[model samples]
Target: MTGKLGIGIITYNRKDILQTTISSIFRHTKTPFEFVVADDGSSDGTPDLLKQLNVPHVTGRNKGISWNRNRVLWYLKEEKGCDWILILEDDCFPSTFGWELPWIEALERYGHVNYMPEITIEIDNDITSGSGTAEDPFIAPMHQAFCVGYHAKALSYVGYLDVRFEKYGEEHVEHTQRFLRAGYGGLSQYLSPERGQLFYLRGGLDTLPSHSHGNPEIAQRNQAIHNSIRHEPLYRHPWRTDEQMFEFREEIATALTRPPVEPPSDPQLFNSIISLGGDGIVNRAIKDNFHWAGLGLFDQFLVPFHTLTAFLQHNFAGLLSTTCLYGYHDALRCRDTLTIYHNCLDKPAHVHASVEMFHEQLPALQYRFRSMIQEMDELCHKTQRVLFIRSWRDGLYYKGQHRPDHSATPDFRALTDAIAARYPELDFRIMFVNFGNAYVDDPRMIFANTRTPDDSTAEEELAGWKDLFSKHRITLLQNR
Candidate 1:
């Protein structure tokens, strides 16, 4: 309680509400605290209002609730050096003077506490203990996240909000569950009798003037992410690596700022094309066609395989299920490919899986496949149409060099056919970026290549691809 207290309000496109909430905080809260607002790309005069109020705030593109909250955490905890932090949504307004005292006390005792707004407060079966008295408020599962307090120590332990939760809904639940599992306390609350008695809630799904940030599709996606990681272990290691944090911060900065593109004449055309473990040909196509085309996981990476069946079953496993290499414990390498983690490591880390190792990791491969397919199923919900580009080659690495033995054209065909069958409703078009055997006579397959021997220029090859895709009623975007 003696250390610095920082209060951060997260607001998005709700200027009037945000101003009112700030006014309420000043009028009702007597506690001295450092205040900041995290603005989620508000284009609706909210930035001007914050400036007018002379409020210290962090403003960036609308990266969603979880990301906005992360900005708050980074600002208050890391930058401002606050020992205690409270995060509030713009719609949650304090009702009484000294309302923060109880929260501060509870945070001191339990390391964390979730505020329960009067309008939405309800007794639930999940209550672990406590009554409505000030001595011991009703303790229950942390369902809502409009307002929450955290001691700096607890904040450090829990880490920043998972930006993967996207816009809204289940992010709070996942964060709270993570905190609870780590053995933190104080999900206790007591509502006041009068309007704005404790905190007035005016947002979320059913409330009047409800939250303007999230849509049903986003809510469903957030729910799926939460459910998938519901049983995952709590953090001892940081929630995200330093490199990942840099990437996420960059994402926040560039959110929704991609160069504009004219919509394809056909609505069924894809907005983005991602590489699915192929060579650099698809990468070249993506870069040449779209002004804002960015790199994906498989771009510029080689996934060498002996057969289609093995590649189809274990490709994702090789990328994700990696382990430290022997004699080079500092380097992690894939079991099925020549991918080594931390390219900065100055160590010998070439990992080509032996036949014995492949057989032994069958269970790991199956588990990774199941997890991968679930993610693939979620892709259908992302866009109306998506084109996946790949190039199949039968090869293996011998002492760290790629040796092409044969063409895996048949295997690529089988893999593409199986996936097309599995997700018949999804427009999952696969483009083979190789020649000779790339021209597969299949409805779901696309054959595009830099025509060899004919000395076809990159532009000529790309034009050929566009014409072919157009014939198949698929529009390929050109440089804008």
Candidate 2:
């Protein structure tokens, strides 16, 4: 009770109802705590409503309920450093005075608790016959997820909502089950009607906009996924694949400690080097593999890997779009020459093995090959030069010649050419550097085919790569 409590209202496309919910919570709830309405990319004036209400909140692209809930958990618990968190759906509004105390108390006593509806059930007489106050609340084993509360201890053990539950349905069920399996007291009816205190009620005063329509197919699919994983150990966070999970965890760990690497200020213009390739460029810089001998090339990167990865992790829905490679950045922050680099390795082996696989899952690959077109056009007034590296061959991995003609990604040549023609002063150039082995042979783009270090050691090869990059930087400077 001494520690701070954070309340989060998960909402999507329900501006009017959310407004009512916020107003109701303010009026009824007596707990002294800061709150946030975690907006799941609401377009129906929800952001405007949050602004008008002056409520602190976070917004991201409309990933499903699970991801939205995870956002709240991450922000309130991890970022805001709250000791206790109470999460409620947009429709669930407080019905009782000092409704927050019991929830917070429940989180303290029982690691987790859920809001039970007023519907009567065959309750255990022994447990139901308690005082039912903040210290002793009427309890039940049944789990209802419309409203839920957790202490930091519970969250650390329970992890997060299973993201595999795409839309709705079984996500909360799976979460509660996981919590129970972790040797903790799971969901309980803290606001039992038998105790004469109803904590909260669902739905707003007026008709609300619906975003998550009940898809029978999705429900069935989610149910199946849930059933399959029911007997398994505590569910992992975020990703399904081990590789992806490890990759995400490592990236998150890096983001936690790594501050945004700032670029040296250009007095006249804002220049940034963005990597369209995955972590390759960042890894090079971090390991001191890249040559920054005298050029200070490392300081020119405005959008480093850690920064971009953190943004993408939060706004994951952007990954589904084939056009948007990068996350949202302030347009004011970017100007002048914007160099974007992408290698063939940007497309992961298992994900983008073929055009069929690439289209099906739409795996979260690094490069959105056509994003530069939009960037170039948008920054035309400020941008004077565009050095777009479509392909760069390193000796680390074998290059695959999956051209734009064969895949869903657009032709970089056609896109850049159009951009160049539209803005003659843009000085757009696409370079394909095939240093180790030449896999892609495209005439429209500039190709730098250099000798492969076939017999060199790892250290020697790394040094060679550093020198190669230095030469490229020299060329880039001359072009500028």
| Candidate 1, residue 276: lDDT | 64
Model 1's alpha-carbon lDDT is 0.57
Local error of candidate 1 at 290, Å? 23
What clash pairs does model 2 have? none
Candidate 1 Cα RMSD (Å): 18.4
Candidate 2 deviant stretches above 4 angstroms: 119-136, 186-212, 239-480
Alpha carbon deviation, residue 334, candidate 2 (Å): 28
Model 1 CA deviation exceeding 4 Å by range = 122-129, 132-134, 186-209, 236-244, 247-480
lDDT of candidate 1 over 418-472, digit per residue (tens): 5556556777777664433334456666654332212234465566556544544
lDDT of 2: 0.52
* Pairs in clash, predicted candidate 1: none
The per-residue C-alpha lDDT of model 2 at residue 196 equals 25
Q: Give the TM-score of candidate 2.
A: 0.49
Q: What is the lDDT of residue 180 in candidate 1?
A: 62
